[model samples]
Target: MKQKDTGVMLLFVTTLTVIIWLWAAGQTKTEATVTTTVRFKAPEGMTSTVTPSFASVTLTLAGPRSAVNTAKAACANGLDLTVAETDGTVSINDIASRLNALDELKTSGATTVSAEPSAFNVDIQTMVQVEAAVEAVLSNVTVSGDVTVNPATVTLSIPKRIRATLPDAITVQAVVSDSALQQLSPGVVHTRDAAIRLPIPLDVPDVTVSPSRVEVTFKIQSMKEETVIPQVRIILAGPPEDYASYTVELPRKTISNVTVEGDIDIIDGIKSGEYAVFAVIRLASRDMEQLISSKPVTSFLAIGKDGAGHQLDVSVENPDALNVELNIAPVSGAE
Candidate 1:
């Protein structure tokens, strides 16, 4: 009877210890579920040709308390996506499975993981490089100095499908900010690095631009104006065949002392004859009789030539001289 009692007590103690161990294990490793987001990262050298339907996915991780928490934190950090070489498809289930396999989320820890979208597909393309010209966007505000841009061009990676839509010329632009005007020093050149903008239309898609910035150099100077009187002359505008035998002249009295306005330095040059400024009267054989019989022919300023070939912007101040008298004479030796 004593032996029997001792054996029964020992068995009862063992059974109680086993129940306590099981209860403690259940308390520490409770089953739990967590909801989190999985962010996708693009692989190198590969870019999406089309916008993805979704940017991220919601995940429900089910496992032990510690394991579920670990996965919840990992998912919070996002996941590096991998695409299948065969079809470039990403399997959401596979990603979840991989997450569940993580050592932190041991099989004993995490029972399973689920993703909202079971799977999805992406369109990828290889980048093609093309060189495009750079256009300058400047405000109408006058610049006192010469303006220039370094690297007047840019290189872009264009999607092959959209390449044909690109015109024979592709262009980017660099804008000169109004703020730049405040930094200008008269007669002094100033340079600043500016951002280059791609003016791709909405229709054109998937393009990457390189060297997105360019150096812009310009000068600022005070504009000066002045007035002067310069001599005027007329040259027939019709074909030489029609005027070969005709000599054209203007009555000196009609055009003498005509007032002119332009850049001070340029006007001074014109007064000194360093640059030529003149006017022309239109004469055509079709209207020759009407012109000779009609009143003074109308004359307008024409580009006058200097040995240096610089353009002059001089204009006549007197409204009357805009019309002039034409004395036409036949050359002595003409057919």
Candidate 2:
């Protein structure tokens, strides 16, 4: 019986010591250091700007061990502050009090002792929603006609300060991806969804557009081919009065090996002479007057119309060299 009683007494003493230690540990004063993120937001019809945009703050909290642990856990998730004032600075001194006042910290009996980052600047501006036109931007393809964008206009939520600096009219771009353009088939309407983007200088934060994606519709032409036309005839043309007053002479009546590129059918027509490729030197009264100085005059060549009086769609190669040398003098028996 004595041995059993001693064993029970020893177990009781050990259990009491552990309970006391646990209670003391729970009530012990402690300090915890933690790093947390800080975010700021504005009310409706308002926009806010922070200097760093993203902020991480370190804080030292003081309280009982349990309370400090609770505060530390809350700090890990960071804090969000609402800006009521239109513009002001957020000082570090203000952050500690705000942290202590947080419900998690307050209820847990934790106090913020200190914080890193002595200060941060914040500015708030009013926001206005305005309608802006959206344009489709395409590349690596030739559009047959005007590109159509569905919901041609979108609402833009722009800050008042930014709006003040912008022009009365605003346009956003719906840029089509290059991959989509490459996959487009020729001679058919292709519909695609492109994300809208603000023009340069306006592509900043706090500017958002409703219906971020717009449908763009366009038709593209087939891949083009290049061909050369040999010995295209060059002609001299002028106003009647200028022609009557001056005799114009051409040094070269034909250009050789003129390269042109366009649709395959158009290229074939040009090569087979079904469509004529010619250059014309046009002279005005001013040109005739300049010729009187007896100096050789240079004139740029203009592409001639086809038999149907329609301009050809082919692009001339080395356009800068498509010129003629003109020699002019007074017509015989004329002043």
Candidate 3:
């Protein structure tokens, strides 16, 4: 009986000591520095801007060990702040005070000694939805007619401050995909849905379009036709004073096997002589002065149209061959 009683007393004493140690540990004061994210949310019908959308804040907390740990965990998760003001800056101290009052920190009994980044700015603006015109943008193909968009306009939700800075009318782009461009051919209308994009200076996070995609319809035209012009005349032209004083001569008066590439109609006109191609050696006063030395000068031959007067949108093949030598001499007895 005595032995059993002694064993019971020893067990009781050990249990009491363990309880006291645990209680003391719980009451121990501690400090911890934790890095956490500070997130700002705007009120309804509004938007906010910050230099870095994901801002990290370091906090120094002091309290009981358990409370400090709990608060640190809470802060690491994140602190969300609702910004009520439409425009202005929120100081770091103001933000820290608000954080200390939060339920998580209050319940944990942790005091925030300091928060780093000492300051930050917030730009809040009211949001407004407006109608913006939509247009189609295509590439790597020749479009014959005006590109048409089905909806013609999209609803844009943008910040009021940005809208105030913008022009009265806003236009968005619906870009066609590269795969669709590869399959497009001439002489037929093509239709495809393209995603809308805002023009630069307005393309920002605060601006959003309701309809993400729009249908674009357009027709492709045959873009390339190659033809050989049998003969192209070469003429020497200059300023009136230079022409009167200097006579220019070319070894070859005309060039043959001149290949050109352009629209089918334009190429046909060139082949049928309805359009004329001439290589002109345009002389300036400088050229007249240089020719006075009697040395042959090389000049670029510029392709020109005849008096018929039509826009020449043609690419000449081997343009380097068109560069010629101009042998110029002063006219007899004319200074």
Candidate 4:
């Protein structure tokens, strides 16, 4: 009786297994088709002159349940379409081959995997990295002081293929807003990192700029004024080697009148004697004692006082030259 019971049990178990298998087969047949969208990208080093119309492809996958599941899982991360050739257009066959080659998709038992629109055209271009200059756009502001820029240029990753041809020069303009210009008052200085923007060409779509911004610095001074200082003494810059035996004299006791023109604030400071403004004649070291007699030499005015470390833009408006006499006799054999 025990042996008979065991045989019956075995038969029951086998019949149940066959029933489950049939049910699973029916389910697979009922839901064997799965469509998924896979994102495709162009190969590296290949860029688009014009953006691609489609960034993704709809793939209809149909096969056994197991295959569909595998394909779905594999495609969940999307597809990378790398082409050895850069013809701007990808064919359906090429895509199919790539999808079939994927181990996950291949093993998934998908009978067919196809893309919608099969193929499409893209204006393709090659990319090149180059260093480009940064130009400052200063409009509606008068620059009376010094202007400086840090990192006056930037590196650009640009596309340079026909339909994607690079211009002879690639430059980005850094604009100084009107608001910024409004802040330029006398003695006012401004420093800031201004963003650089690339002007879109007639048809170019994109450009990549590294260090897209740079530090721009400038000092703004009030409008200049002309001030005349009379009887300003003229001093020789470097004296002759035989100074003890030589004498120098300006035929004119002093500049009849030295006219300086610059920012009012700076000019006032100079006039107040807060800064030392001098008329000087710079002589070449080699010609120190060579002057046998008095000679006229051009003199320029320079500031000795540190006027906020700014070079005074003052110039002598009158008497562009000053004549001076150098009386020199070499001290006994000392040339």
Candidate 5:
């Protein structure tokens, strides 16, 4: 009797297992998500404020078999979130786009509103090592003394080594000519002659200081009263470079109110004749049918003033002489 009971129980268990397996055969389980992403905007301007700087965001997904499979490829493409656009001037649209793209990748589970990229932060405080160019003007400033530079405007790029030491804001040491040191203004005139100082922030690289410091040449400007050489003249009118028999002269001594505008330094130039009279020559075209047709020769100082108070390239020994092989257009005899 006991054996019969045991056999019957085993047959009942077998029947239950077969029934359960048969009922569940064809249905497919819903698919689950793999990943998800969070995207932020790329801000514009100064870049001082933009953070984290993430490019593509990822997301994990789960859903119906087809939807979950689709999520795999979509998530790979990444989410689009855009940085808010306030003013038309900024380039933060990338961020704005990325932020919006996240949703398309995977459906936000009805259970959770957030997407992937669990936690993120943008650090604006990472001591941005940057290089700044400082433009200094020597406007009314003058050299302290007799020093001179080839170009008044010093072009300098801060070296990476030195730039590494500079602060957010940079201040260059004052520049004063050694010769004119005594004549400088009561206060410190730290910068002069369009002198430029590069801001060498801490830990920068691959830069150079132009001229090291400005070249202190002999002299370029003066601070004395402006003086005019009453009889000194500029004689630069003659023939073109091709003309050999061109003769230029200021038959009458050349004198104009010597206008020294900058400072006494320029006045000194007037007295020294280092900056002497510049002569200009102009030839009007014989074709005066209209001022528009033949433009008058522009006023150019073909000859710069020299030390001897005369036109360029001419000396007292040689006098004013040039060979100008030129022919003026003959006057019109047309009807």
Candidate 6:
């Protein structure tokens, strides 16, 4: 009799165990389907590309609260976003790999599926395609019509961290420009790069640069230095018997350094016209290079602090060519 009772009890316990197992299985949630998204930007100077605007990013997300936070890490480095100009084409395969690769979101035993557009729509813009070539200009650099781009302009953002070999000095050999740097009045003008207004292309394909476009600034001293310059004098014996005075051209003028160091006597005597001082050079005609050449000059030291000839040590500077002449003037009473 006890044996029969024991069998009955064992059967009852078995039935209870089956019921409990079924209940636990029902309580466990099946892998769920969730949606998310990703975003990225296209590089500039890109004429075109074969990328989609939107993607149906279905992510197989599963977690026990722990893996839920893992979503943040999923896209950290695993998912790479590709950008395009148009809302072209996308496919399940296009993102399945990335979403599937997020092993962290996968359930231990069950499977999950990612819904379309796992996130939101991405934004893209027209990039201005550019091919950069650094050209050196001394007189003035110009963005001439030679260069062309679809956008015509770009936003040049120099990276704060970019490092490159910056040229110590840019030489502008006295040139005349009509575009911007035309102020050759012998006065100084700190030059500013018109490029400042133009953007510097960055993120070039194979080029690496730091401060790709730097501002070329220069402070021009006065047309002439403040120091006493050698002046030329023009002496003429006679013009034609009929002419009173003749005009001539002494292209180059005498220029002196502000730092003058020489014998006290020679320096002092320079102001007295003792060492063949020439103050008034005559550039009577039109000649450019001829005017720039340094030659001998003849004249008096007529230069003074107040134009009255000051007393100080002065020397012949740039004693190149001097201009002097005799011209005929009509008498007041007679023609």
* Steric overlap count per candidate: 2, 0, 0, 4, 75, 35
- The candidate maximizing TM-score is 2
Q: How would you encode candidate 4's per-residue C-alpha lDDT over 244-265 as one tens digit per residue?
A: 5555555555665667666556
TM-scores, all candidates, are: 0.49, 0.66, 0.60, 0.52, 0.24, 0.28
Cα deviation at 151, candidate 6, in Å, is: 24
**Ten-residue stretch with the least lDDT total in model 6:** 166-175
Tens digit of per-residue lDDT, candidate 2, span 195-241: 99898767887788899999999898764556666666776666887
C-alpha lDDT (0 to 100) for residue 267 of candidate 5: 44
Model 5: residues with Cα > 4 Å off, grouped in runs: 1-29, 36-39, 43-49, 55-58, 83-103, 106-117, 124-335
The lDDT of each candidate is: 0.59, 0.72, 0.73, 0.61, 0.39, 0.38
| Stronger candidate by TM-score (4 vs 6) | 4
Off by over 4 Å in 4: 1-35, 45-50, 53-56, 87-97, 162-169, 199-203, 222-335
lDDT, candidate 5, equals 0.39
The TM-score of candidate 2 is: 0.66
Better of 2 and 3 by lDDT: 3
Q: What lDDT score is found at residue 268 in candidate 1?
A: 66
For candidate 1, give the lDDT: 0.59
Report the number of the highest-lDDT candidate: 3
Give the per-residue lDDT of model 3 (tens digit) for 1-335: 99999999999999999999987897799888999998877755555454344578888899888889899888878987666655555543555676788888889889988788745676556677889999788764568878899899999987777788889998989999878776767879989989998988778877779898999999988644567766667776668877778778777776676665555566677767566666555667997878732222223222326554333333345555566666788899887
Q: Give, for candidate 3, the lowest lDDT window spanning 10 residues.
A: 293-302
Q: Would you list the clashing residue pairs of candidate 2?
A: none
List runs of model 6 lying over 4 Å from the truth: 1-27, 31-35, 39-78, 81-94, 103-112, 118-131, 135-186, 189-213, 218-335
Q: Counting only residues 3 or more apart in sequence or on different chains, how many pairs clash (N, Cα, C under 3 Å) in candidate 1?
A: 2
Clashing residue pairs, backbone N/CA/C < 3 A, model 1: 144-221, 145-219
For candidate 3, what is the TM-score? 0.60
Candidate 1 RMSD to the real structure: 10.4
Model 3 score (lDDT): 0.73
